[model samples]
Target: MSRVRNGLIGRGLIPVWLLLPIVALFAVGYVLPLSQLVLKSLQSEGSWSLKSYLEIAHSPTFFWIVLRTLTLAATVTLICLLVAYPLAYMIARCSPRVASLMLLVVTLPYLTSVLIRTYGWIVLLGPSGPINKTLLQLGVISEPLQMVFNAAGVYIGMVQVQLPLMVFPLYAALARVNPSLTKAAQSLGSPPTDAFLRVTLPASMPGLVSGCTLVFLSCLGFYITPELLGGPDDYLIAQGISLRVLILGNFSDAAAQSSLLLLAVIMIFLVFRRRIAEELDDSSRFDDISPLGATASGLAARRPIVERASLLSHHVGLRIHEALTSVRRPLLRFFAGLALLLLTLPFAVVIPLAFSDAPYLTFPPPGYSLRWFSRLFSNTQWLDALSFSLRWAGLSALLSVAVGVPAAFALVRHRFPGRLAIYLLLISPLIVPHVVMAVSLFFALAGTSLIGSPLAFALGYAIIGAPYAVVVTIAGLKRFDRTLERAATSLGANQITILRTVTLPLLLPTLASAAIFAFIVGFDDVVFGLFLSGPNATPLPMRMWDNIRLEISPQIAVVAVMFLAVLAILGLLRLFVGAAIEGRRSQAKT
Candidate 1:
């Protein structure tokens, strides 16, 4: 026990010493407001009662809201799965170069803020927008479609935003499949369709399940897209809970709604547990990769004319992969051309539009100028909000990493009691909608000094962000060999020195990944920002919310574009860095 303690002390296992500013900041911002939230919820009108919970249970509107939220979440998940599966499967089966390009195209949208990305859908789906204009020009419609502020708009935005979540897991799962298994089945006299059905599909089920779980989990907590795109009557549980707490100040009712929503989501996860577990298992029969006496080329050559035509109908996918990967520069150029049109155009439009002189949105503005950009800077409210956001993000990111690194190490290196439970608790923030958490927090911390402070807000946001850091960091740690640390120790290095020279260097990539994730979580946050932030602590997202609600300001668009650009740059950097590290590791193995 003494040696263990001494070893830990020597290794820098001691917790980080919180700076005076951070401690003061957290106390005022997080701890105080949270306490107030709980006190307010429980001691309403000077008496503690179950009346608030009972009132929420009795409300018909709450039940309907809950149902609508779940329905929207489930629908979005279904759509993401349907669209993402084929894309994921194609990418997985393609050559490495092609697969990488396809994955990049699919995930690029994920780099943008949800608000900005959802706004793109708003423009596309709005009445008299391009879609309507195009249809009219083609003589296919007599009038502009009423697409925005409807379920259709909601579906479009949600599916587009969540598609990557579905695609990523499915792609990972599909990539793990042994290519030869399908070929072997085909050689045993099964038809190609039957071979894939009986072999490839079942083998890739884990990725499909993981993707579905992730998408479904994320969809349940979606606030921005649905709130922006859907009609007021189309309130989901998140919107409902947000209204109850931030707008209506009905803390108890919001808590009850949140508790129920959490329960429902947990139940859904429980139902899908076995499938998800099977998917996560590394020892499963899915990872074998040696090919059976066939290749994709061989399969294509033997296909009958009818089968060929059917395959030809799907030939665009093959061509895309080929174009993306082929040694011929022309083929690669063809793929790049398509990406420019479909993926890059929307992003390009926003950057120039931020400099528009015209008041209204247009493709080629009436003589572009830096009017909005200047206006964005001159706005004191926005400037204050921007400063607040930066400070909160920087502080929250630091604190989250501080807590997250140790927890990740503990999770990766040691087995302890209730480990799984601790994991679930840590990641629960990921599954539970932020609005619901905000509500529970409002109830949980009522009457404390933490309510309405920046620290309280950051604390809540940090909790949400920490799980992502831990999960990513643990993935890095798992890939890391402990042998290097042991070797360093044997060569006369102490624990701290070994960690500094060995573990930290090895885990730096994951650490950066975690930091980026933490920043993104803080940056895109709205639900907690809405509930927790006060005038002094208002972040950029909250400020945007205020601007949108108060007036039709083009400066909001400028803010949105700048924010998106920063996030995109950061995301690209992270991606390249991660890829580089992965490449280095692979080379070392070879």
Candidate 2:
């Protein structure tokens, strides 16, 4: 038995077999459903036709919606880049402890549900919210501004939600840059501003590109933020598709819209695929100086014109730098602090509003009370939704780990044909928009009895959760020391024994992180719940979405606070476990 197992492992058969489960899942859950969607889009009254496409091309409403979607996505991407660059740069230049704390602040809102964040914006930006209230008290404005339910609200909400996606990639890129290179440029007679522009900026291009691509792609598929915050005129493509299916009962039209949207996503993804991969793999060092040197030599040949232009710019930059030298650091700190505060503004507002004595949404409650908390707990609908969310999120995490762990092991431990293709297939969910996946899953499961079942929700959520699991686990496996496994083998242990005693034990931290990420993916999901969730299986996000769209109350804030409390508890527990583990390791070393 041991020889057979060893032979299978040696020949790479074990790794190949381990990949089969995820491959099968994607085939049934992703590929076939998308194929069905395409087919449905092509058929009209059971015959092939382009009627839906033709209608979309001719309809001014749809044309405007598509145009708006693209325009919004582009604008949001640009704004996020502008706002995130300075913050990321500031964080990168900080001490490691400070950088970690700043990153934690930036990422906390990201872990919260988009629905919750959008609600936070509603409370903060509404006429009765804090901003307008403060402005009124100070006599800044005669009346409250119409901030929500318009294009302004959409932009503000979308940017706040997407800011972290931009900051993280930019931080990663900027952090990898060698500080000496900037100093070297300054030493070679470049001004501080000029050095950053030519040296630091160019070095961070990979991250800039990655961050912009992610933000743009995400904005393109935004449904929750726009739906809850924007007016009817601010309609987007995702909303159009949802309307056609859910309200109009026109599956063909919805499928056609989804197909076009999916095509756009695929095209953009393919164009930036290589750069995105480089960023994710942390493989782009930006250390090659040959290109910079070549450009400089080329410029030297045209020095008469270039030198005059460069001299004027350098002189201007020097004067400006001198003028602002005393205030530059303080200015950067202020802007960066403001940006971080913007990221946490939603929770900062919502937590306080949860305790408001007022029956409705208000800032700085007349008096603090637990009425909303009591109401939320006593409400059956809220309890049922919360129950459903927790149960399915837990199941989804388990399902993701069960399949993702083996696939990670296979990809890391063995060389095989089609390995790259397999890895891509596993991570494709992350590339495809959540709305598109939700639509595809809806069509795929409609023919089965599982359409509104908890099992169906788990399966769909797992598809979204699995990519994070595979990526995190693969990273862990790569960083793991294989020597311990060899030592176990030398003790006459079989493959299974070695895996159980040496591999799994050491990989526990990685697996736990992966599971937490997967759980969060399911828990924070609103896109999937929009299309697939039914009366019995509605997740908490879905319930929250309903309340925000229909009624404005303090109970919603209570739910948001409760969810944040849960997350805080989980985070603290993780820190405690990590400290205990480190202490044990210290003892062993001693």
- Local distance difference test scores for all models: 0.68, 0.83
Per residue, candidate 1 scores C-alpha lDDT tens digits across 325-402 of 345345334543443244444455556667789877664456778888888788898888888878887777777777
Residue-pair clashes per candidate = 25, 0
Clashing pairs in 2: none
Candidate 1 wrongly placed segments (more than 4 Å):
1-59, 270-349, 443-449, 481-483, 550-553, 568-590
| Candidate 2 lDDT by residue in tens digits, 326-411 | 57688789889888988998888888889998977768788999999988999999999999999999999998998899998888
Question: Measured by TM-score, how close is model 1 to the native structure?
Answer: 0.80
Name the lDDT of candidate 2.
Answer: 0.83
Q: Each candidate's TM vs. the true structure?
A: 0.80, 0.92
